[model samples]
Target chain A: MSNKLLLMGDEAIAQGAIDGGLSGIYAYPGTPSTEIMEYVQNTKQTAELNIHRKWSANEKTAMEAALGMSYAGKRAMVCFKHVGLNVAADAFINASITGVNGGLIVVSADDPSMHSSQNEQDSRFYAKFAMVPILEPSNQQEAYDMAYFGFELSERLNVPVLLRITTRMAHSRAGVQRREGKPQNSLRLPSDPRQFVLLPSIARKNYRKLLMGQAAMEIESEKSSFNELISGNNKSLGIITTGIAYNYLVENYPDQKSPYPVLKICQYPIPRKQVEELYNSCNKVLVLEEGYPIVEEQLKGYLNTGKPVHGRLDGTVPRDGELNPNIVAKVLGMDVAEGQPIPDVVKNRPPSLCQGCGHRDVYEDLNEAMKVYGTGRVFSDIGCYTLGALPPFNAINSCVDMGASITMAKGAADAGLVPAVAVIGDSTFTHSGMTGLLDAINENSPITVIISDNSTTGMTGGQQSSATGKIVDICRGIGVDPNHIRVVTPLKKNHEENVRILKEELAYQGVSVIIPQRECIQTFARRKKSEKKESND
Target chain B: MKNDIILAGVGGQGILSIAAAIGLAAVNSNLYIKQSEVHGMSQRGGDVQSHLRISDKPIASDLIPEGKADMIISVEPMEGLRYLPFLSNSGWLVTNITPYMNIPDYPDINEILAKVKSLKHHIAIDADSIAKEAGSSRASNIVMLGAASLFLDIPFERIEEGIRQLFGKKGDEVVQMNLKALRLGREFSEKNR
Candidate 1:
């Protein structure tokens, strides 16, 4: 008997890793990827299978921890969104040179169209830069099968594999078949004792080895069973699809019959043979890729291609935004009913802070305190408070990356933007804001840093934050003057005191951190329910 | 048989719980299901939706096609109407008339109901009052699901069993309250019919 369960793409990866003998899954919470680690943590499989699953302080730490597990000769999987990859890039780029004893797979979930992200950066580019093999699955079953087989492939290739998925694949659910369980790798060190060590003498040789393996990696791609060529009756148009884009391409042809040759590419490195065959077979090619036109560019060549290549760069399909079945249908010259435009009565309803949230109190008071300083002085980081840029409050000015608020505020302060204030969240403060605070303290940048301590990662479904119960100590230990490290409960009752403290910190010259301490209302509500249940029992 | 439903509501309005109920029922009937949810930053009091597709055969795409949804089950009137583009021309629209007004520019309550009534196949009810009468107002999403269940091709017993399996952890009293809310909603729709 076989096992079939309805699982999201992220859950499929988690289950695949579990079935594939994953030793550990280390990751910081982020969209479309957070559920991967959460699934393992809440599963009985982790306990019975002796898998290590825990939330790390940040993506960089998580990446390094996965690398450490790989160093001990155990299979490891690190999952994160595209931006989190930016945080972990330092560790990722080096892992290519250091190679691995056991298999290591980095699953980067890209949010195309900026769904809950700052940018729609393609992670395949990162994988290409790192000079690693990439497995881009096209469906939920493929997502599962790739993870089930990805570890072995990584070990065989002796390099980390990048499994890139978009928001659609990660969040969507479909039934996935399971494979037989495998035993975890026994403890073993790398054959080269100094391989992991990045000393120049050993690294130079390792770099040469990595570069030498590129041709072999390309051969592996050409031989990958995931890559396929489907022949049709007619050869007027050839279609090249990678990852989820294949689903959309096939969706246009319900009976799976089209009058065009199709090269469905799930594994990367272009699979030169398959591309050459398709290009030689068809008159023109339509490249369907979710993100950048990387494949089209390569196929088009520097001087020009043999056949006209049509894609995002050529305006065959819109360069920006997501590719849907409707968009695919339009591209295929099929009839698509255009949905009516949104009624003018339906105004823009952007995301806002929850009612009675502690962040609301913090913002309400901060707006009052900054009335004299005017607008555009507050630089915010990613979190629920970023919504303060909306109407009712109109509080914060800028929100660049995860921890750019403090550093940006410092730079502005140096550039004569007086009273430049930085607003950040509890989880975000610990994520990357701490280092920037240290920099500000060292230079004594004239800025007031407000750390809205909500006791949990409020924006991401209230995950337990690393800064919980240690925000004050963290501020004090980070070299901020102890006397100036102010803490207040962000409540409607304490609005006056909160505003007064904000005023005081804004007036102060040196760096000051005002932590508005309050447990997130959602988590608090959950706690109350559990507490009441316990009392009744 | 196939059912494509768009479960709609504001973030934190318990639309997922409603989707879970239908998903559990669909799975128990041995039907294939694909549910795509909105996660991350937009979930913070923003418009949120889930596309739930159930079929006897294996499902292809996680998302339903435009103007092809069989029904729209929503916890808020505005949220339900927001997804009219996804509904087929003859699709059923079941929604709560209550406005969870977190936005500053929320429209007049009568205006929303009038628009909903314009649909040939629609059921607009105040799920909040019915849920409050049953037990807890948090079960309003369940009520909306019950009203929508009248139009689903799936059986009613499966949905009732689904509620039992979904709310099994919350104890009998809470479960009974939700069950009452579900039945109350069904009775109201039947009375209107």
Candidate 2:
């Protein structure tokens, strides 16, 4: 069992967290980051240890819960995708002021190429803004090793550690070696009384302490094993790689040797001294990073020393999209082999809502009902229902961030767009939509909010939704008129009746909610399959 | 002792099982392997591709560069053609002839098959029928994998063992069905070539 195991970077991080004495893990399901929690949940060790592995309602709640576990003197890890970090930014930014008694690791899986994400926002900026130590692994082994030692680093520095990974690192599978396990920490309060309290007098003092602690954090980064300086034979061009970009750089070199002085900066605060070494040793500098040119931008400071700094900011590298070995080779001025282009016979195959999905039925019925009102009035949240923006359905208008549907619809309704509809998933409703629903109800906004209840988080592979079987109670609790809150089964046979219900909700002057409740088709099939297998056994 | 493979197919087409089988065999042979997969939104019936690399030497990038793939192995016909840009000039294109028409604008099956046949090194297999003969239509992905196995440098018996190890949890009957499916697919490819 101690031998090398084939694991995805996310799985490796989960194993490392478990082996490194994790007492709790919290996360809201999002792509690239979802597998980290799913792996921990599926593992036998976490279950045996009775570790807290339940999904949180949203990323902010997840972040706070993890901080709470850390407050009780136990190692905790909070994971989410790049956008989820935006949701958790409030707690994440303040955690640095109120240092921790136990280790805390915040894992942010970024999507640089907009792969399964709306925007290519970098999570490193969030870490930097919070003034926390960052760990960006270059490979699967480092991903595991960082998680293994990251807790100690966090505890030693008395601050939360940020483990930032991109989509490639999160989803790629490689062999990872295991490390010796550490025992879980016992529950104990922080030695400093009033540390968690953020009163202005104490908060001002804590903020100063955090500012003073930056030097120590940078020193730890300077000495981190993940940060290495490799001296090369040539000095014409010095290359700096952060995270998985290091792999793409070394991939062009089969001998695993680059001609220029290379500073592999996985641990951050830029590891100032090593960067200075590389900057001084070579004539020109090239910074390769997966997402934004964070390091590159820093190197080319306000008053440049006139040393050439080439990266995404300049035309040296493509400003957008993810980096690949071919891109690296091209930038290195190497001849890359051009393959045959795909024939015209192959067409675009964008992701679509699965056939027989409840979202599809909801979209069909809603589209039919919206024919009179016309399109561009249905505001949708993030989920499978977002695909309704595509052809065949052409139902929804906007697919902004989660919970934006109801709030945006309310705003639009406030702007004289009457009966603006909001299409949201059940899981999303609990995540952040409930509060918006409350706002709409209090204002009596004339918006038809469609809570397309799928009973599970369908987009990120059917995680247990926080709002399963509770939509009706939630709506009632939000003060929506019970009569205006209607439930309809979204099926082809019930399409006519479902359309009628939607139309009625749309016509209402006050706030109205339509719940199209059905289990996800994929999850339903899986449940039926397992049930059949059980009966057979 | 290196093979760069691109596994392409529509989501829910079971290409991951094909990847699992190949990955197990590669790991069993003590080779270094890296597989990059598409997850989340792409799994709900979208075009998905996995870049799989196995080598005697340590692999660096999880992704394979364009025009360097040793083979384009697909469980669906058009899916195979979609990755032709990644396939090497001498590389083989092994694909199932069956069409997965989930999209509304899917091209004609005959034209897709004709394009596949135009390639110098290709194996267009009726793996659906072959899998049906082997006792389960669900094993079509395995059949496609079996056809692609001929060009793979790994030993054939190791692939059989891989299927056993991968599906061992499902019971012996399922494994046996897949083994038969693999064999039928291999025999068809051998005769056709």
Candidate 3:
């Protein structure tokens, strides 16, 4: 029987990891990458195989935990969005140096055009900086195949492999044929006693080993089936495509035949031999990459290669955003008829907090309270509450990275922006706000911190939050006065009371945390539905 | 045969269910399918769309090229117009007449309807009423899918089986309600078109 299933690219990666004998999959929820872990968590195969699937507090914790699993001689995979890589950079770079006893694949889903992200930073640069092999899947099938291939490559080279994907590659669905399941590796420790230790003397040896492995990694990229040079008769213009960009190129050529010789590179390390061959044969080259112009920039260094290489830098492609078949068709000089301009009658509909959302109530109360304190004092973190910066409320002043709310508020307070406030979600607070809270307590930084406790992550589809029932204890543990750490239910009826509590906290000279405790409306609705089903039964 | 469709709706409107039924049907027919979905922040209440492509040959891009979509099946009238740029000149616009008025500045219902009605090829149905008539208003997405199934290259029976397979875990009652919703929608389209 054919074991074919229709799966999203994220689900394909999860199923691939399972079939590839994954012992554990660790992640902190973020878009385009969240579904990978969610799929693993919900799948029957993982439960039957006893695979460890749990949400980590943050990307750094997830990366370190996956590294630790690899240290135990069991295959582990860590998944996160592109920006999450910034949080895990320290551990990620060092992991390459420490290498691995078991296979480790770090899946970083990049969001081009800022789809669900604050920025459009490509993850391939990080892999290049760490000098590890990178697997960029061009489609759903490749996304699945890469997991199995990445694990083997990771084990073969004794290094962690980076599997990079963009939003389209992660969220798109296609049919994927499954491979036979492999048995999980039994629990065992690394053979080298001092391998994971980063003592300076050992570090030098590890760094040298990583630096030396670049050649072998390059060799692997050259021979990888994922990266290939398709022959074409026309040699006037060659093309180099990475990741899903290759799909756009093929999409323009429906016959699956481009007139120009194309170097389809889904593996990193440049695969210099194939690239050089293509570059040498064609009179000019066009580089197509999804996110950044890493390949284009590399191919055209400070001293330009005489052959006119064109890409983002040269304006052959629009400098930013994702590539679609229309863009490729236009670039290839093919006529494209984009149907019609949307009539002006269509109004823009931005995402807003749900009507009954606790975050909406909190923002309403916060906006009302902030009227007395004046505006431009609220620093918010990444979450659904970040939506407070928009629309009817327009409450928050800044929406930076996760956990930046508290620290930025403290810094602003230090700069004499007195009565500065930080509003963060419960999940984000536990993710990184706890440390900033500790800092505020140590010096008594006069910043009012509002931990909008929704009891679930609320953003990225309500994953289990580590701070679900422990926010009060955590605040008390962090040395904030019990009296100052007030809690309130964010509801319409309690609006005045919540505002009074907020005013008290803002008046305090020391650190104060006001947690508005309410269940997320979406999750609450889901619970009600399930509960009603149970009652009906 | 190849068919590229754009499923459009407001988030939380159950458009993914519509995409799931069609995807399942395409898979059952042994057609190559690729569907690109929107997730994360915009899913709160913003406009959400899915690019669904099915072909006898292997599909390449997850997104349909501009002006290449064979049909746009939207659960909301205004949401359908949002993807007009992706529709081919001859593409069909199958949308529900329901106005998901989450936004403050939603256009007049008649204005949106006039725009939809002005299209060369379009099917605007009161899927909510049809679904309710079929025993469940929650199956409006399935109704929208069925209204669109007329233009889809796949067989009608395949789509019925697809809905059955999709709602099977929810029990036979739910499946039967959705199947009834599907038939009512197809009936409405057959009468009107």
**Model 1 lDDT per residue over A38-58, tens place:** 889988979987898978899
Candidate 2 lDDT by residue in tens digits, A1-537: 115799999999999999999999999999989999999999998889989999999999999999999999999999999999999999999999898878999999999888899999999998889899999999898999999898999999888999999999999999999999999999999998799999999989998988999999889889988999999989999999999888888888867788878999999898999998988889999988899988999999877666999999997999999999999999999888767898999998999999888888988898899899887899999999999999888888899898999999999999999879999999999999999999999999999999999899999999999999899998999899999989989989999999988888899999999998889999999999999999999
lDDT tens readout by residue for model 3, A220-296: 99999999999999999999999998889988875778889999999988999999999999999999999899999
C-alpha lDDT (0 to 100) for residue A338 of candidate 1:
45
Q: Using lDDT as the measure, name the better of candidate 1 and candidate 3.
A: 3
Off by over 4 Å in 1: A1-3, B133-135, B172-176, B187-193
Q: Per-residue lDDT of B86-169 in model 3, one digit per residue for the tens? A: 999999999999999998899999999999999999999999999999998898998898899999999999999999899998
TM-score of chain B of each: 0.97, 0.98, 0.98
When superposed on Cα atoms, how far off is each prediction in RMSD?
Answer: 1.9, 1.2, 1.1
B87-131 per-residue lDDT for model 1 (tens digits): 888788898998878887888878888888878888988899999
- The segments of candidate 2 whose C-alpha lies over 4 angstroms from its true place after superposition are none
Worst 10 residues of 1 chain B by lDDT: B57-66
Check candidate 1 and list the clashing pairs. Answer: none
The residue-level lDDT of candidate 2 at A172 comes to 92
